[model samples]
Target: MKAMVTTGARQMVVREVECPRPASGQVQVKLEYCGICGSDVHYYKDGKVGDHVLDHDIVLGHEVAGMVSEVGEGVTDLKVGDRVALEPGIACGKCIFCKSGHYNLCREMKFFADPPTPGALQEYVVHPADLCFKLPENVSSMEGALVEPLSVGLHAAGTGDVKLGQNVLILGTGCIGLVTLLACKARGAAKIVVVDLYDKRLEFAKKLGATHVINAKKEDVKKRVDEIFNGEGADVVLETAGSVITIAQTPFLTKAGGTIVIVGQSAQSEVSYNFSEVIVKELTIKSIFRYRNSYPVAIAAISSGAIDVKQIVTHEFSFEDSKMGFDTVIEDAENVVKAVIKF
Candidate 1:
């Protein structure tokens, strides 16, 4: 089997590696497609994201979908020839977080492409049978690969408690932001205002049902949101840009008693935030750490035609040109919303 390995910053190579066999309660999948996430881009360009630094060569991909080649001992429900989307994070079932169903916060989480754990960028990957969700007959492999990010969007909306007739503010137009918009619409948000510096992404967002698109470079985001909400601000604010500026602006952009969900993981650890306004307004601040128990819901939404997850894919690359896919994402930041590796 061939795997795309990142040796250092801005370095990647396709190298032959031994194919993995699934242990008990696991399954071996021949990967068909894998989406390159923003975290993957950060790890490729800087060799680190916050404290999770890439100390050694590792495969970089987590959004994955493929066909089951073989099922390990003790595995039931799923069998050979089943197409499935894999939930990347594996948690310690014995931990309190896992027992309580908040496994995304488990202390010992082995997430794909997160430095130590090898990802599905390779030709084949072995994952827990329980984590490999079967794809509906109507969903394609590429669409299946998108379920991971869609799950993140679902979790963000759920955390923010987005509801009907609420004004939703999204701070970015990237893949995650667009998916979050879809989730909000599915949840019956009346007005969705998406903010981004890129006009191309903003245009795409508009086509995908964004009620309004604001270019942060040309317009004042706070003023625009104020105008839309008649100075009351948005009911739900989701910060997906991971920018220090946008994260800090959440307090001002959110309405009194509104909820703000931080969906993006910032590269910087600390940001000077305005605590006085947050306290005075009585706003609720929440954050998402990957996602838990969201993959199934995302799949169901896509299957039911409630969400169009694949339209966010603006680029694709063959497994042999996987490095080029990463390069396209890095260099073409404005145009390439999402890039997928086709195996």
Candidate 2:
């Protein structure tokens, strides 16, 4: 098997490695596609995400989907030749959080590409059968790979409890931001407003069903959002840009008594926010850590033609050109939305 390994900051090389076989209750998948996440770019460019630094050479991919080549003992539901999407995180099933159905918050999670755990950038990956969600016949492998990120959007919108005919304000136009827009739109948001620094991304957001778009670089975000919603503010404000500024702007953009969902992960741990505005508005603020129980929802949404997950792809690269793909993501961040590596 061949894997793309990050040797150091801004360094990646293809290396021959041992192909992993599945154990009992697991399945071996012949990886077909792996999406490059923002965290992957961070690890490739800076070698760390927050405190989870890259201490050694590691495979760098998590958003993945493929066909089952072998099924281990005790794996009855899924069989060989079945296509599936692998949930990257493997949480301890015995934890209190897991028992309570909030498994995404489990403390003993071994998520793929997060430091010590090697990611699924290779040709073959063996994962637990329970974590692997079988894709519907209508879904493609590329779309399967996208289920991972789409799960985040589903979780965010679900957390905010976005209802039909409500207004939404998305504070970013990145892949995650766009997916959140799709999720909100699918939930029947009457007006979806997306804000970003790049005009191209904002245009893409419009094509993805954004009722309105704001380029923060050209105009004032808060002022434009107010104008779009006619000073009433959005019913739900989701911060997916992971910017400290956007995170702080949530309170002001959300409607009184509306919900604010912090979906982005900022690089800086601490951010200055206005608690007075939150108190005056009587707003409900919520946050998500990865996602729990969203894979099925995302897959079903895509399968039902409610969410077009495949439209998010802006670039694709062959497995051998994996380094080039990572470099394109870093250097051409504005142009490239989502880049996938095909095995």
Candidates in order have lDDT scores of: 0.94, 0.94
Local accuracy of candidate 1 as per-residue lDDT tens digits, 39-97:
99999999988888889998999999999999999998899999999999999999999
Q: Which regions of candidate 2 deviate over 4 angstroms?
A: none
Query: Estimated TM-score per prediction?
Result: 0.98, 0.99
lDDT tens digits by residue: candidate 2, 1-343: 8888899998988899898989999999999999999999999999888988888999999999999999999999999999999999999999899999999988999999987998999999999999999998999999999998899999999999999999999999888898899999999999999999999999999999999998888998889888988997999999999999999999999999999999998889899999999999999999988899999999999999999989999999999999999999999999998999999
* Model 1's TM-score against the true structure: 0.98
Residue 114, candidate 2: Cα error in Å is 0.8
Clashing pairs in 2: none
